[model samples]
Target: MTKSLVGYGPIRQTRVGVSSSRGFDSESLGYHVGQTLGYGGERVYGRLDVDYDNKGGKFDSKGNRISPDVNQTDQQDTESLSVNGSLGVELTDSQRLDLAVTYYKDEQNTDYGPDYGDGLAVLFGAKPSLKAIDGANVENEPYTEKSSVNLSYSDDDFVGSGSSLNLTGYYRDEKGRFYPSGKTAGTQASEVWQANGLTDTATLKKLASAATFVTQSEADIEVMGLRAAMQTETEVAGKKTLLSYGADFERENSEQTYYGQDLNTFLASNGLTAQTNGLTYNGGPDTTIDKWGAFVNADMDITDKWHTSAGVRYQKLKSETDTFTPIYEQLLEEYFNSPAISGISAAYGIDYQAGDVEKGSTDHDKTLFNLGTSYQITPNDQVFANFSQGFTTADIQRALRDVRAGFVVNSDNVQPITTNNYEFGWQGKHGDTAARLSGFYNESDKVVRFTDDYTVEVVDTDERIYGVEGSLSHDISDKWQVGGSVAYTRGQYDKDGDWLELDAVRLTPLKGTAFAQYQFDEGSNIRLQALAIGGDDKAFKDQQKDPDASALPVTGYMTLDVLGQVKMPVGRVDYGVYNLLNKDYLTVYHQTTYGDLNRLPASGTTYGLSYTVDY
Candidate 1:
């Protein structure tokens, strides 16, 4: 069982103004403004169960069934609306100006019930059908809309001693649409039970009696963006200096059209319908992308306790495509006359065409760097260090088509997806007590993976993480005050490998938080809180049967919360409670094939209250 429904609405506005001129005599001006609006929605339903056990039959085949049970249902809907505005002006005492605008619209609807099949028909024991391998009934709808704008200007002299200057600009737009619902035989009997793994049920009733579900299609998308920036600050040698620079440009163009029936003329108008179950569509044309960038940064204070910063960045990218279709020139002559894909096309000896890989274009360039340092040691202590670099790009639907013309085998390299970061830190304060600590290291390259029906694969592998973040605060007298924070992480996947099944383990190793507050002299306050998160024990990928006891081990739990506040006269009043201990935890796991992974369950003990006013 599956179900979902959600909605949203928002609006905001702001304005501010001020002016002054001194000479033992002053002229003053002031203005301020604000506005806000909001809305909300949510609904969900769930259920699923799959059980199988056959030990000692040494793997039985033929519609393979030992203990089978399957059932399915799903639903989804989403909505959104937005608006924002801002303006600020002060042209005398030091010059200032600002303007902002934002608009957005969103709508979504999804309905897929019929127990959406295809995990090899729930692993070989088929039954429970919604019919569609051309027997018709499946649906889809997608939508999107967006808008943005911003502008700014600033200047301050204040006797030309601690100068300042600033400038900013921005723009954005987006539109999208998609609708699908024709081509059934239950979606080709769930893609021939996920590409040939259909353990016979009379070959799934002779491929669901020669299926043919075709009748829904439409798509459209658009995107645009722009940005500009500049900033400066001074007070040189005496200590305190800052400088920033920027330049940016972007362009994207896309067009797609693929309507009802044309997958090889509906598989030659339904004639040799099951040579491994038909209809595998592919498309890519009318596409364009462009990008440009520049950046620089600096922050200095050489001595008097030392401080430094540096940065650099540059980027350029281009892509293009359009042309080639006739069902991709007859699947590129049946993948160059098969032979198990022409021996991987003579062992990757290039030139494997579908129109010699038509409509071509490619270009890329990148550069990034940064450095930092800080030290004080006394006057409350301080220390810091940093280094960074990151980049990402590649994948325009397999870079403009041609994955060995559909039998797969093409390595026309185009790499990008890099990162290198390091950090060290310390901070302290006494007399009410305050503190901070940090440690980090990250190195990643390439890394991109998605299969199980969503192609795209790339792995260079390299990951190592080290963590230690801390926070502490105290003031246990005169109305009390206390705080706490803790973090610890250890992630690994540093070479020497073989672990793919959407690998990305370690998501949050150890986390902690604690809080307390009390005040009885002013209005009123009382609060208490606690939190903890953890992860460890993960590994899965065997493709069937004891690949050494099929891994699955996850166990860790903790939760608690409480709050209260009061200050009435028509203004402050709040209350809250959560978890408190009604535990039956499970925080997420879903890899479905009825390997049944859906458990983020834990919600009990809830309460809320609120009120505010001051005019």
Candidate 2:
């Protein structure tokens, strides 16, 4: 059977590779393997690929090893798998059908260490009895699957001999899941507020050993959509002209649930056993979103050296969320009425009530437009300018989910975001060298921002960003080449008619990369690259809500990498070394589960080697 397939003129191709390396901490071991297959013929073709990787161990800033926050028995780890495939068939010379599918999954065991807010006593220079909880951990797992199919038709001449037409239609479906589970130790509430300032060591130690906390959450999302487009081209006034139109329809659904519990509590030692089973639950019905949009555009070459184009789009969106009573309300009600809990409730001045939970829905319509022009500078150079308007509806999950008051708030009246963008660019090539430069300015309103505490809300002020980017590449010879790129950006947001610098994560002011490569005679080559990131001018302060949060300052770092490939008789070998200098740096800052600033550690020196066999 294999011999017969090869007799058909090499209709199939395949390649496979395997590699092993270490994670950033120079301790965790990581391994990966991948394979790709391709098939081609006169009328049909398809391709498929799969990849998997996994790693273990954890590291903190300052090059120290650390364990996960919740579990002393496990180490922080990550594993993932990806699969993709595409198939296409040509029914005729003027028609074709294509299909594609993708699947991906990632599982992470994260260590959160100790609770962030357990140091209030230490911060005040007072030695209290409650010991900090140790070994906190969370398991975060997310996965997605998507598939799409399309059919296309084209004709050299449709209604007139001088005009051409092309049409296409496509459908896609996507689904995903998010689940997080964690555990922690609880702090003593009474020791921190002792009236006598006793400094009693026995009391503090007993308080610390009284409780254990656990949490779990789950979210599922699905989106399906269909789209179609038609385009026509002809000669007008002895120049090229084109007209195009398209429409899209989509529906999305999201479901979310959350739970929290205190597994063990020794409040019974204080004659308060009524709250031993501290259970909490927050969830409701699913959120549904439906949206549709249509667009049309026209383009024409006004002259031999000039061209212009214009387009407009109209979109309509509607979202609805179901409501239901939270499970915690029922549990709280039972506790409130119990005589055994009366003394504990009075000691803490506890008062609780559930708010009205009702269904919510929103609908809106938006319009967007764009215009562009280009001028030929020479035979190999051109300059272009464009202006466009865009809009995006608020995320339905954020607008509808109210799992907890401070964790996930519900905002039914959230508005959409609108932005205007202007851009200019130039590109040219001369002999063995090529270059490009571009600049853009963008302004937006009703920007939705997610705070550190896992809450999402719309900002009232307007925001603007401007940036410039450039790239250059040159071929010194058939064996050697060099290239580099640079980018700079500035951002500001309006507050009471005042402009303040934007403090978001992706606002790096300056960044650049340069690389050089050398080619060998037997299809082997080596390349070296360097990357530079600039630090922020000022630190970002928390919104004054989290007293324990540290000020976040952007940190700049540089790294180098080397990659090479060598040819063999039946296969090829490839190798690469990353962060060659073992630079201890920070990649990004994130909000900890406790609403405090947490710095993400960058990988140190690591290397990988892989062998590939092709058929």
Candidate 3:
């Protein structure tokens, strides 16, 4: 339908401009340039924006390595380019259409690992760096990129007189990959083995020499979707009313690949590829999902004091996957067939009973509903209550991979979870002050737990959570303003009927922020802000995998900062002194996700300045 409507032709440019900025940061130098173009004739009008940014190195919060090598630090770094555009066409007096497109690429060093502030600062515990490796050159380079296009059409006659119909279709292709991770057979192998219950260093070296073990992953995703909506505006029984209905369909396919690092020199100097195909396996799975849903809603003036709306949706989703696991038997086959000494059974005496394995799939569907109503107390005040349902499938790939080697992976073996959420809140504004308060609770038969491996581990247990949040802002004078927000939350899981506090990873700590702002002029302003986070001790020797896993209690801390903007004669400048008080601290992600071995300090006080000009 879109092919027949929009014609391909040269765009007539109307306006164009470019802006650039130079930034100075605590650890590095950076800059970015942005350009925009406006084009169209009478029927077609649109604008395009493009930008390129070269961020500085050591940009990550903990990027300052604990014990860094000459060039083996800055785990968190990025460089990128992006483009976005939207166009509209007036097909007729009563019909119109719009199109939007987006694209971005993170030109980053994908396989470069993050600094844990501990190890010898090497790659995969084996290689010195990516520059030293000759194998998996393309495979070792992980990256992120995506492109998408969307089309929307609306017409009054699409449905009937007085009824309007809207149609939208979109397609997107995206790919993202992360760095390689594993216990390298290099210098750190001895320490890693000790942690995993191996003592004899010689035997550890001998076994590690025999094969390469690590985990790396990436996903190539493609999506195509379509949705149609129709609405009519008319008077119903002398009351102003509106009714709308819509249905949507979408199909997504993601080809997931997970494999170990390709170590080129494990056997000897410039030795054979130790991480051979027989010794390797894709720990990730290819997945496809087909989904379709429909919903209807009605809203009416009903009265000037009250407004109400209710909607219900019936959705069906089917998830299918090509599950996988390490096929060790393939190692035996490669051993006899290829020149590489691939078989682990002969040299290692390790049990390879997981032969002739079979893969499985996951299937789920649900019907969801929702309702909401709001009452206007005054011109600037309102209160609302709402309830809703949500459904999703957990990380089937991780669950499938964790299956016992001898068992099969199916819906019966690798089950997914369904979740429900409930929320209510109030918001109002009076005079020069505004405020909001909210409470939320959610539960599920099984919860999706995130792990440091960058994978979701679905725990087959009943989990419940409840929390509340509040925010307030006030203008003390024409030149002064103040505001703040506070939140508190807790969660627990059913463990054999003895409910236990959730891990710090799943639990939200008590946190709050306050700020004060002053205006020097209409175009210049400055602000000061502060943040505080409370600690947690739930998983500290309390959970099943206790006493030293993610068992470390989270630590609390507070910090203050100053940020401001001033209009200059040539352009505008933005500056900030983050962590102004130099309240030295570490990231909460560290304590809640990793053990003491990964104890790394967060960034100290840092400063930033940037200037921009529009032309």
lDDT scores for all predictions?
0.49, 0.59, 0.62
Over 1-615, each residue of candidate 2 has an lDDT whose tens digit, in order, gives: 111222233333334443323444444556677777767666677677888767555443334454232211222455677777776666665555566667776666433333223423322223322222334322233344555555455554555554445555555555443332232222222333243252466754544333233344555667777776667776667767798888888888877665453322212111111121334444454778888899998899898889999999998888776664443343344343346544544565544454434666777778999999999989889999999998777665654443332222233355567899999999999999999999999999864554543445567679898999999999999999999999989876665675666653536657899999999999999999999988764426432333322325566778898999999897888889877777777654432222322233555666777777777
- Tens-digit per-residue lDDT, 1-615, candidate 1: 111212222222222222111111111111122234322222211111111111110001111111111111111133445556554555555665656667665444322222224432422234534221222122233445666666666666534644555566665666544433222233334343434454457755644433433332233445455656555676666766787777777767665443343334334422112122233444445566677788878888798788898889887777665554433333433443445445533544423344433565667768888899989989898899999887666556443433433332122454566788898989888888888988888767655544333334554566555678888988888688888898876554433464322222334546788888898786788878777766445434332232322234445566676777788775566666655554445443322222331221333444444544433
Candidate 1 stretches with Cα past 4 Å from truth are: 1-301, 309-365, 373-378, 381-387, 392-415, 418-426, 429-434, 437-470, 473-584, 587-615
Q: Candidate 2 local accuracy as lDDT?
A: 0.59
Candidate 3 lDDT for residue 133: 28
Considering TM-score, where higher is better, how would the candidates rank from best to worst? Answer: 3, 2, 1
Model 3: lDDT of residue 194: 53
TM-score for all predictions?
Answer: 0.26, 0.77, 0.79
Task: Give the count of colliding residue pairs in each prediction.
Answer: 21, 11, 0
**2 against 3, candidate with superior lDDT:** 3
Worst 10 residues of 2 by lDDT: 265-274
Q: Which stretches of candidate 3 lie over 4 Å from their true place?
A: 1-27, 39-42, 59-77, 109-141, 156-160, 183-212, 234-240, 264-280, 326-359, 406-411, 414-416, 450-456, 541-551, 594-599
TM-score of 3: 0.79
Q: Which has the better TM-score: candidate 1, or candidate 2? A: 2
Which pairs of residues clash in candidate 3, taking residues 3 or more apart in a chain or in different chains? Answer: none
